[model samples]
Target: MFAPQGPTLRELAVQALSSVERGYDLLAPKFDRTPFRTPDAVLAPVSRALRELGPFDSGLDLCCGTGAGMGVLRQVCRERVTGVDISAGMLAAGRARAGVTATAPRVEWVRADARALPFGPVFDLAVSFGAFGHFLPRERPELFAQVHSVLRPGGRFVFPIAAPARPGSLGYWTLLAFDAAMRVRNALWHPSFVMYYRTFRLADVRAELTRTGFDVELQSLPELGRRPDGSPRCRLVVATRAR
Candidate 1:
């Protein structure tokens, strides 16, 4: 669902046909108006969880679209915050919205690919929001490694992941249909826009994080409540760089 200020159907169609970076560029200004932006509900619990885990100095928001995660980092990190994204348009919107002043923790925006981060051991905390679906399952290792590379020893890479839908549920069918449609679109289109709804699995992600040298833990976001089975409706994956 989108707000009155969000992109029109035609604009969304155009974005879907473009490459990921260019698509995001076109969608940047209206991104926060769409449901695709990380919900403040999720961000709040994640920030609370991170605070319990840290008094971190520096933070990085990987794939920081319009810098929503940067707000969370600002609350948990003490010294500086950096937002790295590949879309120039997104970075521009982020810079405008962030309004980071000299009084706040120094905020920097870098236009760079997440698969090849430019920083090294420079961050004590990192957070990504609603961006993993852009990468294919096979690319997980490299992406996780990139985040690992940028973090200091004992640094954390945190993000919220929702519980998977049951097989016969409406949510399951919706995700399946969305992924199928995306596959069809990618097959028919050029410079493929690679946003899928169901590619990132928590178990697989945890294993990949471990392989990338992170000590993984899952923290239930109880504020979001629980499913009928009693499992958390959402969780925060806290992947810490080995000390």
Candidate 2:
């Protein structure tokens, strides 16, 4: 769902047809008004979890389109917060709307691909929100490695992951249909808009994070509620760089 000021159907269609970078550029100004933005409900609980795990110094928000996760980083990290993304438009939108108070840490924005992040191991905390679908499964190793490379020893790479929809459920079919449509679209389209809903499985991702040198743990976010099976609706993946 979108607000009245959000991108129109025609605009969304145009964005779907463009390359990922250009599409986000066209959509950036209206992004926070769309359902695509990470909601406060998710961010709040993740921030609480990070606060318990932290008292951290420098933080990084990887693939931080419009910097929703930067707010979370600002809460738990004391010194500085940096948001990095591949889209200049997204970074510009985030910068315009940052509204940082004087008490908060210094905030910086950089335009760079997540597969090859530009920072050294200077961060004590790193967070990403709702941006992984842009990466293919095969690209997970490189992506995880880049995050690992940017974090200091014992620093964390954190993000939330929802439980998969139950098989035969409406949510399950919806994600399946979306991924199938994306595969078909990429097959026919140029520049390959790479968003897909179903390819980032938890088990596979956990294995990749481990192979990339993170000590992985999962923390349940109770505020998001639980499924009928008593499983958490969402869990934070807390992957620490090896000390």
Candidate 3:
């Protein structure tokens, strides 16, 4: 759901019809007001988790739309933080929102595709939030490889993954319907907007990370709570580049 200041239904309809990049560009100004933006509740737990795993320097916020993960990187990383994204409008919004103080680490915004990151093995940590759905399952290998290439050996690529909604639940049906509609839209439209909720399975993601040279670890985010089945509601994927 969107807040009072969020994009209107007309605006959203226009965005949904546009290319992913153009759609996001149109939404950038009011993205934080939408449910699509990573919530602070999620960010707080992730930041706490990163703090436990860190004392890290030089962090990267991959696909950093409006820089939500950049806030987490600021708390965990000591030296520099970079927010890389393909959307120039989103980057512009993030830059405007980011009020850099002298005390905080250096922050830079780079416009680049996540599948082909333009950097060496420089970052000690990399994190992404709410942007994976834009990448199709087939593109994940290249995406993971790019993350691996940018991270220093032993550096982590961290992101949170909530447990899938239970079968027959409202959440489950909602995501299923959303993905189905997206598939139909893409099938009929040119310059397909690629976003599918059901595609990023944890098992498959772990396997891909392993194949891409990451030693993967999953940490439960206790602050986010647990499901009735006693499984964690959310977990952080900390994938360290092995070499």
Candidate 4:
């Protein structure tokens, strides 16, 4: 659901029909007002976890739309901080944020694809938030490799994952319908908008990370609390490249 200040139905419709880049460009101005922006509730817990594991130097926010994870990086990383994404409009939106502009460490915004990052092994930490749906399962290996390439030997790439929705729950049906609609939309549309909520599974992701040279670990984030099954509702994935 969108706020009153968010894009209207017609505006959202036009965006959904456009290429991913163009759609985001059209939506970027009001993106923070939409449900798509990473919420503070999620960001706060992940930030606390990163702080405990870090005191890291040069940091990177991969697929950093509107720089939510960059804020998390600023809390843990003492040196250079950078946010990279493919959409110029999204980067501009991030640049205009008061928090980003006043960050203590130097901040850089790069417009680049995550599948083919244009940086060397320079970062000590890399974090992403609420952007994985944009990447298909087939693209994930290369994307992981690209993140691997940018970090120093012992650097980390981290992100949070919520437990799968219960089979008969409202959340599960909602995501199921959303993914089905997206599949239909992609089948009929050109320059398809590639976002599907149900595609990124924990088991598959952990396997791929292990295959991509990361020493993978998962830590429960108690700050977010647990599910009815007594499992953590959310867990942080810490995948560190070997030194």
Overall local distance difference test of candidate 3: 0.94
Alpha-carbon runs more than 4 Å astray in model 3: none
Error of 2 at 229 (Å): 1.1
TM-scores for every predicted model: 0.98, 0.98, 0.98, 0.97
Report the Cα RMSD per candidate: 0.9, 0.9, 0.8, 1.2
lDDT of candidate 2 over 7-95, digit per residue (tens):
99999999999999999999999999999999999999999999999999999999999999999999998999999999999999999
- Which lDDT tens digits does candidate 1 get at residues 78-164? 899999999999999999997758765788999999999998899999899999999999999999999999999999999999999
Cα deviation at 188, candidate 2, in Å, is 0.6
Off by over 4 Å in 2: none
The alpha-carbon deviation from the true structure for residue 46 of candidate 2, after best TM-score superposition, in angstroms, is 0.1
Question: Where does candidate 2 clash, by residue pair?
Answer: none
lDDT of 2 at 201: 86
What is the per-residue lDDT of model 3 for residues 133-186, given as tens digits with 9 covering 90 to 100? 999899999999999999999999999998999999999999999999999999
Worst 10 residues of 1 by lDDT: 98-107
